[model samples]
Every structure is written in structure tokens, then in C-alpha cells.
Target: MSRVRTLEEIPLRKFHWQMFFYTGGGAFIDGYIIGIIAVALAVLQPQFDMSLTLVGMIAMATYVGMFFGGIIGGYLTDIIGRKTMFLLDLGLFVLASIPQFFVTDPAQLIIWRFILGFAVGADNPISATYMAEFAPSKQRGVLLGGLIALWYVGYGASYLVGYWLLALGDDSWRWMLTSSAIPAIILLFARLKMPESPLWLASKGKVKEANAIIQKIFGKGVILSESFEYKEKTSFMDIFKNGYGKWTLFIALFWTLQVAPAFAIATYIPQVLGEFGFADGNMEYLGSAIMSLFYLVGLLPAIYLVDKIGRRPVLIWPFLVSSVVLVVLGITSSWQMSFALTITLFVIYGIFNTSMNIHQWIYPNELFPTKIRGTAVGFGTGVSRIGASLSTFLFPLILSKYGLEVTMYCCAALFFVGFLISFMMAPETRNMTLAETSTLNKPSIKFSSKPSPKRETV
Candidate 1:
């Protein structure tokens, strides 16, 4: 049999594109789903007589489903295999999304949305882990960053189509929601023929099988490393037992702090613009689509610099910029702000917030090893969803009671706090291999034997 191999040692090849495209498709689905809400809520609020509370809940429903879905998917992907959950989650997305078009009531739509969220939750961990594990070590950050960048592309696509459909009159929301299913369908067929993760196979002691797969990736004559050893099963507690616990803490604090504000802004961009008097015609949708482009553009520098510079600097500096500009934007909100001024600040904030947020996608995959990578990613991503769900649910309430300035101020606060955490705690993960990261020391953490809460860690 050919010698066994480590994932990092493999040569980067054209084959990586298949994995990237497949996973990127899933990321696109996530973006399209989140972005569709901009138009869906606008149409629904008038059509269904949607109260702010109901509107919040309808949006919250998907996050709620995703929270559990990410957690459950972690276990399933880790225990079963990457390819199974990889393909399966896309199928669930298709099934759940299709029902959205036919819903006559909020309750029905909520159920379908929840189901769709669950699929999104599952897809996040599985896709992120797959990309990290298979990528050449030097290119890992770039590969992972690009995977998330596709989310912005997907978000942009939703706006282009949503605005066009919105002009179609009453059935606009249905087409907007249903159109997301097309990408998921395309992803499903693409992923069906993809290979299993070799790192995961090695973790299961399938050395011979892993090598055979690597041959296809690195060409037939290559010899491989045999250093990896496998355990038959994973202990959920192990992820928390060592320094891994601190990494888990970072993911929770870092991801939630970013997502709560980022998503809230994205979800309500059209409405926020409406409040600023861009209310009539497709200008709001058109403006929303234009702004989405900045987020995608923001990802370009991050894709180039995330590995080149370092994760902490890229992550922290952007948050500082995002937070400071947010304060300026908030103060200007009451200064009789001109539309040009407001859009300018939002453009700057959008770029920084999106670029900084790429770290969340890159870190979870880098922090854990093959054995627990899925579970860890799923759990950490799930925790972040709690913050996302809460912020989305509470956004309207906060916006209504406190108005735009306070809402922007609160968003600024979250980013500022995240900046401190990242500056103090974000490890230099940019150029490190997954194995190197898994063994890196923590900055200083308080640990206890009190098996952490189920929701807190794996």
C-alpha cells in the first residue's frame, strides 16, 4: 500500500477548485437566504400585516433552526463522515426552501424557514472544515476566506434578483424566496460526486483508503507521510479538556460580537434606507444591491491579506475602523445628516465589518483537528447563531424604541468590545497548519473540571 499522508503536505492543484466551488455554493446559499429577507420582509409587512414582533420572529425562526442544526450537524458529520453531511445538508436546504413559495400563513413560512436555517447551520461547519482540511497549508486561509466571500456574492445576487422580482407586484416575495432553491440544487448535484475528506479518513485509521484518495489529489507516484494515528471515536469532552477550550471561547465571543450587528444591519438595510427617505420605487432595493457590492469588495483585501499579514491584525484593525466609523455615523444620524454623508459612512462600515467577519469562517476550521473539527465548528458556529438570532429578533424592538442613532451606537459598542477581545486574545493563526494551531498555547485562561455546559462547548 502507498504511504499515509498529512493534508498539509499535499500539493495544491486544480482539484481544489471542485471542493471550493462545491463549498462556495453552500456559502452562496447562506448569503442568498440572509439577503432575501431584505425584500421578503418589505413585501410581507404590508401583505400579511406583519407586526414588528412577528417580523422579528419570522426572521428569528431561521436562526433558531440553524442554532440546533449546527450543533446536531457537528455530531453527525464528525461521527459519520464529511461527504455524507456535505451532500445531505444541501438536500435539506432544497426541501425546506421549496415550501417557502407555497406558504399561506406566517406559521407555515416560519416552519419552512426554520428547516432551511437548520440546513444552513449544518452546511457552515461541514463546508468550512472540508475546505480547510483539503487545502494546501500555505493557501488554507485564502481558500477559507474565499469560501466565505462567496456569501457576499450570494447576498449580492439576491438583491439583483429580488429588486427585479419586487417590481413584479404581489408574487415578488414568493419568487425571491423560491429562487434561492436554484443554487442549492446546483450545489447538491456538484457535491454528489465529490470525494470524502482524507484527513477525516486518516483520523478514523483508514490510512490505506486515505492514501488512495490522496493519490488522486497529488498524482499516483507520490509518497506520503504516515504520522497520523486514529482513534475509533471522539470524546466530546476532549474538545474542552485542553487548551482547545480557550479557542472555543474565542470563537463564541468573536463570532457573536461580529454577527449580531453585521446581520442586523444587512437584514434591515432596505428599511434603514427607507427611514432615511429612500422609500419610493426600486431605489431602496437598488441602493441595497449597490451597498452589498461594497461588502464583497471588502472581502478582496481580506482574501489577499488574511494569510499574508496575520489574523489578529486583520481582524482587530477592521473592527476598530468599523467601531469608530459607526460612532461617527450614529452622531451624524441626528446632525441632520445628508443622504450622501450617511451612505458614505455606511459604505466604509460595510467594508470593514465584512472583511473582519471573514476570520470567523477561517478560525473554526483552523482551531480544531480532524477528529473533532466538525463538532467543534458546528458548536462554535451554533453559539454565534444564538447571538445572531437574538440580535435579529430584538433588532426591530431596539430600533423602534431607541431609534437609528442608538441602534448604530449599540452596534458600535459590540464591535469595540470585539476589538479588545481580538487584540488581547486572537492567536496568530494565519500561516499555521491545522496541526500547528491545535497545539498552540492559550494566552491565559481559567479552566475548571466542571464539564462545561452542553451549549457552551461540544
Candidate 2:
């Protein structure tokens, strides 16, 4: 009799690609939801007669919702199962998205945007967990990174949509905000066929159910690996105990430092461009659209290098290069700021900063065990959004009061601090199995708890 193949040993198949497309669809919509609003807010500010503070509140509200959604949705994902939460969140996205077309006041708009953001937040950890649990260890980086790449694609697409729609007269922002519903509805229906994660199922001791899924999807030749037998009681607190506390802290820190500036800058790139010289509204929106391409270029190299050279190098080196770029831009903010020089610096920063951002999806999922992966990811997402929310809210206030030089300097400092922390703490998980890379195998690694001899596998 032939030995049954493990999920790790199987070659990439049609199922994997289809799964990524279906699972990754949420990310595309997430990109559109956030990205469209960057330009939409430009119109919203003047039309709504919003104060700078009110504009900031409207901008910050989605992330505030993200903060709550990540925590609540993440816990529920682990408890109720990835498949259930997967469809439900997108439904929320649809319901929240349609109301944007009808809001009569700033408060009503903020409420709808917050609800849309909640859906996006819940989908973040859920999609990452689903992809990671099913992906071959060798290709996990690309699969996870591709999910983020889709986010940029969605973001970039939104810019294109917003740029064109800006020509549609004063009410264009409504259409831009409501457009997210199209993708959200499509993904909700598409994902209904996706199976529950086999690894998650195996971890729950549903071996028969898991094996049926394995054979059904991966073929009759594949079976549950021996590693799946290990089982233990899981708690929400597990992510904070057993040496996980340090990882939890590291993920939250790096995630926050990376996103706070990125989100702030992306959210207000038009205004930043205005300061630099592209003061025309059309020109500013056009420039922001072009900047999206630079980010996509940066992500391509990272997807290749992540599994090639290892995670530590991919995470560590980009932080250094991106930080240096920001420092240069900050120092030059006092100069005349020629278009060529300004665009060059912005392009370089966008590329490298976006490159490093891929790890936000990769790290938290890799660092924790299957049992607590959702909770850990949720915690990281929620904490990072707190920073993002504050930065988005405060960015305009600071820009108005302190000028671009001060704002650039502050962001530079944050990126440099991130470089230092990542250098000291980033772990290498290049070729290791999920069970091996997580706390399940390495007990002696400082603050971690000892793993039991029992193991779980898919």
C-alpha cells in the first residue's frame, strides 16, 4: 500500500488558486473600501462643510470600527469557524456599503463607514487564517503576501475609480463609497462553496471530517498528517501567556509603526501633494493614483524574496531602507520641493514601505498556534489600527499647525524605531512547518511555554 501524502507534500493545484481567488476577494473589497474614501474625503470635506476636526473624525471612524471588529471577529472566527465568519463579514460589508449613498449628515456617514470598516477588520484575520491553514508551507509566504497584494490592487483600482468619478459632479463621492458593494456581494456568494480549513478542523479533533475534506479537495491520496493528533484546551489568554506575550508585543508594535504613517499618508496624499506643488485637485488625485503603482511594484519583489531569502531579511532590510527614505524626505521638506525631487522621494518611500507592509499579514498568523491564531491576529490588527486611527485623526491637525517638515520628521522617527525593534526581534520561519515555527515545538525560546509531545497536523 502506498503512503498517503500530507498537505505539505502535495503540489500546488487548481484548488489552491481558486481558493486564493475566492478567499482573497475580501481583501480586494477591503482595499476599495479604504482607498476610495481617501479621495472621496477630499470632496466630502468641502461639501459637508466639515471642520478639519470633523474631517479627521470621519477619516478616523473606520479604523476605530476596525479596532473593535478585529478583537470581536477574531475571537468569533476561532470559536464559530472560519467559513461562517468568512461569509457573514462580507454580508455586513454589503449592508453597510449601500447606506453610504443615502447619508444626509456627517454623523450618519461616519456610522456607515464605521460599520463597513468593522466588516473589513473581521475579514482581515479570518482570511489570513484560512489561507495560512491551507497553504503549503513552502509557498505560504507568497499565498499570504498575495492576499495583501490583492488589497493594493483593490486600493489601486479604487483610485482609478475615484479619479474618473471625480468628473461626475458634486455627488460623486456617494457613488465611490457605494461601489464597494459590488465586490462585497460577489465575494459573499463565491465564498459560500469554500470548505472549512482542514488544519483547523484537525486541531479540533474532527479527524474524520478533516480527512474527508482533504480527500475531497486534495485528492484521495492525501490524508491527515501525524502532527494533527496533538490537542489542548485553548483560551483567549493563550496568546498572552507561555512566552507568547513577547511575540504579541512585537507584532503589535511593528504593525502599529508600519501602518500609522502609511495610513495617515495614504489617507491624505492629495493634501500632501498639494503642499509639495501638485495643488490642483485633479493633479493631486491623479498623483495619488500613480503612487498606487509604485506600491504594487514594491510588493512584487517582496512576494518573490520572502520565501527565497527568508522572513527576517524581508522584514528587517525593508524597514531600514524605507526609514532612510523617509528621513531624506523629512530633511528636504524645507526646500523648494521640485516636482521631480518630491515625486521621486514619494515613489521610493511608497515602494519600500508597501514592501514591508506584507509582513503584517504574514507574521501574526505564523507566530501563534492554530488554536489562538485568530485571537493573536485580531489583537495585532486591533492594536495597529489604534495607531492608524490616531494618526489619521491627528495628521491634518498636525499638518495645519506644524507644517510638512514636522510631520515628516515625526514619521521618520517612528519608522527608524520600527527598524531597531524588528532587527532585534524578527524570527526566521522560512522553511519550517506551521507547527514547527509556532510555539508548539520550540519551548526553550526564552519566554515560551513547553510544548506537549502530542502534535497536530494536516
Candidate 3:
């Protein structure tokens, strides 16, 4: 009998790309749902007569919901399994989005937005893990990087939809919100036809099932002889029991710092443009439209370079460069200079920020064992959502109190913190196996004495 080959031995080709698309569509749904809300707020503020503070509150509500959803979803992902949580969360997003069209009050809109955010929060960990688990090692970076690119595509699409709907001027915020439902539906159908993660199956001690799935992907030669032995089922305490406590803390802090600047810029781009002397009417929308194009362009190379250059460089350099650009924008008084500076900063920020965002999904999933992957991801992401929520609330206050210049300076400061954190602590996981990556910084226990050899054989 011939021995079976491992999955890595299989050729990389269209099959992997097909899988990337199916899984990536779920991410697109996630991005579309979240990104569209920023644009819709511009239109809805006028229609509903909302105060700037109230609008910020509504945006924060979504992040608040995301905080809880990420925690719950991450916990459930390990408990009920990834596929189950993925489907259920998709349903929640679809259901939450449909109600926005019927909202009669700002308060009601805030409630529904929070609910939608809770459901959408599950996407980061689940989709990233799903893609990583299924991808061949050689292509993991590109596949995950491309997944991030697709997410930005969704972001760009949201802006395009918002711009077009607002132009209709027929009270079209409903159309803007409803547009999200289409992607959600498409993802639901696409996911139905996809297979479960074989790595997850093997980790759960279902070797035969895992092997069968692997065979389908890699042909019949892959072996199933390895045991599915794992440490006892993990709990929240496990992150601390091992030496992972420090790592987890740093990751959570890193994510918090990351979201602060990114969300601050993203949530207030239109308002920021108005400050730069762009007309409050169509010109605000036009600036956003142009910025969105730059965003998409920045996202592509970031994704392409993420795996090729390794995670650390891709993550750190972009943030550092963007920080300098943001500082320049904050200090410049010339409207034209500030506008060009803001666009340049936004483009660089989008690229690095998108790269960091993609890795946020990938690294957490890869950092822990399958038993604890969901929990760690949820905790880290949930904490980050808290940061995002705070930033959303604070941005408007900063704009009102100190003006856009000070607010942007604050954003630059946040990015500087993130840059330092990434530079100091983040691990290089590119092309490494899950087992290899999980052991970083773990302590080795040395026995006080070596055990004597058994002498009973005679």
C-alpha cells in the first residue's frame, strides 16, 4: 500500500481561489454592513434632524453591540463549532439590516444599529480562521491578504451606493441600508455550498471526517494516520495559565490602539472634508467618492505584500508612514494643502490599516490552539471594539471642542502607539504551521531529575 501525502504537497491553483472567494464573500458581507453605516449617517442626520452628539452615540451603539457580539460569538464558535456560528451570525446581520428601513426615530435607529453590530462582530474571527484553516500554507498570506482586499471592496461599494442613493434625493437612506441585504443574501447562498474546515475537524478529534475532506481537496493520497490529540478543552483561564497572558494583553492593547485612529478618520471623513472648505452639499460626497477610490487602490498592494513580505513589516511600516502624513494634515492650515495631505494620509492609512486589519483576523486565529482560538479572538476583538466605540464617541467631541486639527493630532498619536506595540511584540507567523506559531514565548519546564531506566525486564 502507498503512503498518503500531506495537503501541502498538493498543487496550488484555481481550487484554492474558489475557496478564497466563497469564504471571502462572508467577509464582504461583514464589511458592507459596517462600512455602509458611516455613509448612511451623513444622509440620515439631515432626514432625522439628529445632533452631532446623537449621531456619534448611534455609531458608538453599533460598536458596543459588536463588543458583546464578538465575545459571545467567539465563545460560541468553539462551543457549537465554526460553521454553525458563521451561519447563525449571518442570519442575525440579515435580520438586523432589514429593520433600518422602517426606523421612525433616531433612538430606534440606534437600537437596531447596535443589534446589527453585535451580529456583524462575529465575522472577523470566524471568517479569518475559516480561510486560514482551509488554505494551503504556501498561499495562506496571499489568500488572507486577498480576503482583506475583498473587505475593502465592500467598503468602497458602500460609499458608491451611498453616493448614488443620496443623489436620488428621494429619502434614499432606506435604500442605502437595504442595499446591505443583497450581499448578505449572496453570502448565505455561497456559504451553503462551501465545505467545513478540515483543520477544525481534525482538531476536534474527528480524523476520519477531516481526512475525507482533505482528500476531496488534495486528491486521495493524503494520509489520516496522525492522532487528533489535544490538551484538555480550554477555558478563558487557559490564556493565563500558559505564558500567553502577556501576549493576549498586548494583542488586546494593540487592537484597541489600532481602531482608535482608523475609526476616527473613517467615521468623520465627510465632516473633515467640510472643514477643509468643501461645500456641505455634493462636494462633501464628491470628496468621499474620490477618497474611496484611493482607499481601494491602497488596499490592493497591502494585501498583495502582506504574505510576500511577512506580517511584521507589512503591519508596522504602513502605520509609521501614515502617522507622519496624519501629523502633517493636522498642522497644515492651507485648505488645498490640507485636502491633498488628508487624501495622501488617507490612502497610506487605508493600505496599512487594511493590512493590519487583515492580520488582526489571521494572527489571533493562528496564535492559539483550536480549543482556545475563538475565545482569544473574541476577547481581543471585543476589547478593540470597545476602543472603536470610545473613539466614535470622542471624535465628535474633539471636533466640537478642539477642531479637526487637534482631533487629527490625537489620531496620529493613537497610530504611534499602535506602531510601537506592533514593533515590539507582534510575532512573525507567515508560512509557519499553527502548532509552531502557538508556542512562541512559552516556557519550558525542566525536570529536577531524569527518570531512571526500567530494570524489570530480566
Per lDDT, the best of the predicted structures is: 2
- How far residue 433's Cα lies from its native spot in candidate 1, in Å, is 1.9
Clashes of 3: 0
Which tens-of-lDDT digit does each residue in 102-207 have in candidate 2?
Answer: 9999999999988987888899989999998888777888999999999999999999999999898899999999999999888888998999988778777777
Q: RMSD to the native, candidate 1?
A: 6.4
The ten-residue window of minimal lDDT in model 3 covers 449-458
lDDT of model 3 at residue 69? 84
Which lDDT values do the candidates have, in the order given? 0.82, 0.85, 0.74
Least well predicted 10-residue stretch by lDDT in candidate 1: 449-458
Off by over 4 Å in 2: 229-231, 444-458
Encode model 1's per-residue lDDT on 1-458: one tens digit a residue: 45433456555778888789888889899989989977888888889988999999989888888889888998788888999998889889888888889999889988998998899898888888888878876788788889889988999889888988977788789989988889888888888888888788878878778879978767664433333446557767767866788888888899989988888888888988777667777667778988897777788998889878878888999989999998887787767566666677788898888898788778888877778888888887788889889999888899899898898899999999999999988988765556666667654523231222222111
Model 1: residues >4 Å from true position, as ranges? 1-6, 221-226, 442-458
Candidate number that wins on lDDT, 2 or 3: 2
Return the TM-score for candidate 2, rounded to 2 decimals: 0.95
- What tens-digit string does per-residue lDDT give for candidate 3 at 1-458? 55454454344767788878877886777667667777788878987788889989998988898899888888777766778777888788788888888888889888998888888677766777777666655566777777777877777778778888886675688888878878887777667767777766766767678788878867776643233343336577776657778778877987888787787667777877787777556776767767766666766666677667777887787678767778877877355654566566567667666667666766776677777787778888788999999999889888889987888789888888888988998877776655556666565622211211212211
For candidate 1, the lDDT comes to: 0.82
